[model samples]
Target: MADLAKEAASLHKAASGLRTVRQHTAKPLQEFESASHDLSALGALGSLLGAKGDIEEGMTTLVKLAKQLDEEWETEAKFMGDVSDAFDLLEVLLTAAARAEKG
Candidate 1:
């Protein structure tokens, strides 16, 4: 009967030790879960920054196209003005030639 009692006490001590080990193991797992959440949030932030960079690139492209169009129009306007002045000078020269032939 004494031996039976001793065995039961040993089993009780072993069970308590197991519970303590489980408690210690669970703390690290909880810390790992928290770190996992932080890493996931950082990944999402990185993706957002990449999207912002793409938008900036698109806007820069648009600005460059707009400036190119403005320069083309400015050059076209100057060319048209020069053509108009040349036509006017040619008409005046033709008039002078006609008057000189009359004499």
Candidate 2:
């Protein structure tokens, strides 16, 4: 009975650890931590049989990271396009002025 109590206590600790990992962390910063807990929960079915959707939750974190990357890429693309167009206009203006002086 004492051994069973110790086993139960160990299970409870693992359960508490998994919950802490899930509730306390968010994307990017908690990515690795969430993964570690998820894998542990997978190995121990007793702790994670109900939260099977955590894998999808992990994917959601990745989706957030992807969205952030897309936003940055779009910002960079717009800035580059604007700069290129400005240079084109400047070159045209400079050429027109040179022609007028030559005339």
Candidate 3:
């Protein structure tokens, strides 16, 4: 019974830590997504304006930057998903522990 309690406590703590990580990462992820959208719009605008030479090069750089941001966002999203999964698994473990203790 005591062992089950300890395990449940540990699982709960792990879930809480993962939630904190998710919270901290959420804002930066949102900001990256917003910036990527803005960059794409700027690139389209440059094309519509008939950019040439240096202007075209700048636009290209912007596109690259946007792509990089998108890639980073994807990586972060995957990390968040993994963290969420871990939290879910911990929750399940805690639930199981509780049931075991009760039974």
Candidate 4:
């Protein structure tokens, strides 16, 4: 019973740490999205200026790369959310264990 309590405490600590990390992760992702939007605006301006075909193509490639990066970050965010859900489940289990121990 004491061991279970220790394990629950450890898991709670880990879950809190993960929540902090996840919050920090969001800031950079938002910054990246903002930068991507700025780059897309630059790409549009370059098109309006009649940039050389090769230069336009390069800009397009960069935009695509930025989009890909955004997608990857979104996937990572989803994974983090899933991990958070798992933590919630662990917390629930811990609560049940404590209740059973009391009973």
Candidate 5:
């Protein structure tokens, strides 16, 4: 029982750290999405203007890849945050149950 409480406390601490990571990463993810949007918009404008040179084509590819990367990053961050939340809940429930059992 003591060991269980200790493990729960450790997991709670890790969840807190995970929440911090989520908060810190969110701002950078937003910036990355903004940059990706700008690049994609520019690519569309260049295409409309018949700017089909090698550099422009390369940029178009880069924009596609950037958008994909942005999406993946967003998904990953959201999952991380969700996992943190679940861990937090579990820690709370386990701690409460342990206390009740002791009483």
Candidate 6:
């Protein structure tokens, strides 16, 4: 029971850390989109090579990927929190059941 408690504590800590990460991720992803805007200048060079369409297409793909990553990370953080809460509830129920059995 002691070891189990320790592990549960560790998991809760990790979940908290993930929630923090989820909060911080937006700024970096926004910066990434800002940087991608600078890359649009490459379109001029691509035009000379007749690859402007390809460059624009690639840029669109990159933006979509960044958005996807942001959404997925948000989802994962939510899942971690939900799982942590479930464990806490399970622990409470188990303790109650154990005490009832002893009585």
Residue 12 shift from truth in candidate 6, angstroms:
3.2
Which pairs of residues collide in candidate 1?
none
Against the unseen true structure, what C-alpha lDDT does each candidate score? 0.54, 0.56, 0.60, 0.60, 0.60, 0.69
How does each model score on TM-score?
A: 0.47, 0.46, 0.49, 0.50, 0.50, 0.67
* Ten contiguous residues minimizing lDDT sum, candidate 1: 33-42
Question: What is candidate 1's TM-score against the reference?
Answer: 0.47
lDDT of 4: 0.60
For model 3, the stretches where C-alpha displacement exceeds 4 angstroms are 1-51
lDDT per residue as tens, model 2, 7-96: 545544554454444234445545664564555546557345755466657666776675575555556555555554555566667778
What is the Å distance of residue 90 in model 2 from its true position?
Answer: 0.6
Compose the digit string of candidate 3's lDDT tens values, residues 34-61.
Answer: 5544444456665677643455466557
Residues 5-64 of candidate 4 have per-residue lDDT tens digits of 565556556545544564565576557545644554556766687654555466557656
Off by over 4 Å in 4: 1-51
Worst ten-residue run, lDDT, model 3?
33-42
User: Tens digits of per-residue lDDT for model 6 on 7-76?
Assistant: 5677777767765764676687677766655656666675688676665567668878867876776677
Candidate 1 residue lDDT tens string, 1-103: 3443454455445544544553555566556544533444446665666754554456556555655655565565555555545555665677779899998
Better of 2 and 4 by TM-score: 4
Q: Report the number of backbone clashes for model 2.
A: 0
Model 4 error, position 72 (Å): 0.6
Steric clash pairs (candidate 3): none
